[model samples]
Target: MKENIHPDYQPVVFMDSTTGFKFLSGSTKKTQETVEWEDGNTYPLIRVEISSDSHPFYTGRQKFTQADGRVDRFNKKYGLADENAEK
Candidate 1:
């Protein structure tokens, strides 16, 4: 452990601009913006384009693609689908 050599780790607010989702966490990143948190304390505000709140993987709102249909077509052409597997 060294003194005066590490970046400052402090409470910061990550805000998702698209979804307006705010999260409080400790980070070494600095920001010029400040936001008043629910605890009545001002913390550094970092704006992010995407977060878990708006991401497709986290929200499970991903677009349905034709890849699955293509896989079914391939399976049917190669007779890979087991009849018992369907039942």
Candidate 2:
């Protein structure tokens, strides 16, 4: 409620490189990079590696792995398994 006490809130563009998804939203984070949007307007551009578009959960490309096998492999490599203990 104070005057000039809050940081500037402006529109920002977050770009996901994996899916080429560009999203415009408001942010208070500071950045030095800028880019011209499709509408002939310039906004702050933030580059990211992943977003909902390319994420496994949202895109339904989730991978299933055998965790037990991974544990066995890790134990074999590091000699962490107890040889005297029952399996």
Candidate 3:
């Protein structure tokens, strides 16, 4: 309802610093940098430390430890009798 009171919401190009990946998005954040997009137009450029392009979670490079089941944990903690070993 107000004029010139709100920050400009415009298309911006966010670039991942690690992967050099660039994507177009809209934001109100200010930046002095600019980049020519694929469409041959200039847009504000914002560099980010982490993005989906290089994130371990998004790229499936995350390491996860397999949790031991209840029986396995109990056996390791109190030593279960090894029936197969005896046979």
Q: Which candidate wins on TM-score? A: 2
Query: How should the candidates be ordered by TM-score, best one leading?
Result: 2, 1, 3
Cα lDDT for residue 83, candidate 3? 70
Q: Give the C-alpha miss distance for residue 27 in model 2, angstroms.
A: 0.9
* Residue 75 Cα positional deviation in candidate 1, in Å, after optimal superposition: 26
lDDT of 1 at 25: 97
| All models, RMSD in angstroms | 7.1, 3.8, 5.8
Model 1, range 10-76, lDDT digits (tens) per residue? 9999999999999999999988999999999999999999999999999999997675577688888
lDDT of 3 at 68: 70
For residue 37, give model 2's deviation from the true position in Å: 0.7
Model 3 Cα lDDT, one tens digit per residue, 1-87: 988899889999999999999999999999999999999999999999999999998999997765977777787789886576554
Q: Lowest summed lDDT over 10 consecutive residues: which window, candidate 1? A: 78-87
Off-target runs (Cα >4 Å) in candidate 1 are 66-87
* Tens-digit lDDT string for candidate 2 (1-87): 889999999999999997889989899988999999889999999888999888998999998886678768798899897687798
